[model samples]
Target: MRTRTTLAAAGLLLTLTACGGDTDDKPSAPPSLTEEQRASARAAAGLPPEPSTTARYRFLEALNDIDRRIVDGKDGKDDKAVSRGLNQCRSIKNAAGDEDKQVALVQQTLSRFTIDTRLPDIATPETGGEILAAVHKNLCPDF
Candidate 1:
């Protein structure tokens, strides 16, 4: 997961640089960072890699698109959201399809985000339910 995210960042940089450079001197080839090197690079940037497949990445992207008062799209905070999201998925799976348990798990997980929702502090249960629905539809359809 971390590798993929780091690669994404690095890939974007490589693509941008490769797109256009000095018209005089040829652009130098980009160095491919090893796993440890990539991990260090990601750590330096403080961005968490997307978890699981491209589906989960898209899910989080869509989730962040909402005004859910979360900072998952930010640099330092995205990792926490990814970690909490993956954790919630595992917890929901462990709940064995119990709706109440799943809802509660999501509510608990919501505390992990830096939210600025309609509520004063915590997000509404309805919001949590919506998040859970997205999770089910996106991350854990089997659950």
Candidate 2:
């Protein structure tokens, strides 16, 4: 009986560890992008020339900052910031009539992250490409 109890307790402990406890929290590392990768991604996407080196860095900084915030559970702030940034990007594409390539590139990049669509009032990218396509459609339907 004691042996059976010990085995059962061990099994329970293993199950709990595998199940990740009652909380859904999982640890994750911060998101980052290298300068070369950023430049390559922008070039592949046919982005407009950077206003300046500072401007280019600012754009990437903003993206990483928001990504970290989202991962840290700052959902409301993240949503608002991402929405604004995406809208601005869309506006630029619309004005330049260069939406398609940008959308495709963004879709490719966004695929690196896990999208959560179950949240309230959120229309997350099912794939990185989908979000980019949607943004293009919304901002520059002509493209």
Global lDDT of each model?
0.61, 0.48
TM-score of each: 0.50, 0.25
Those runs of model 1 whose alpha carbons end farther than 4 Å from true positions after fitting are 1-53, 114-122
Question: Taking the tens digit of each residue's C-alpha lDDT, what string does model 1 give over 15-50?
Answer: 998878567987689998787887576445443333
Model 1 residue 42 distance off true place after TM-score fit, in angstroms: 21
- Top lDDT model: 1
Deviation from native of the Cα of residue 78 in model 2, angstroms = 6.7
Worst-scoring 10-residue span by lDDT in model 2: 114-123
lDDT of each residue in 43-140, candidate 2, tens digit only: 56644323344543344354454344333346465445344434445344544645675555543435333334322223244444444444344433
RMSD of 1: 15.6
What's the lDDT for candidate 1? 0.61
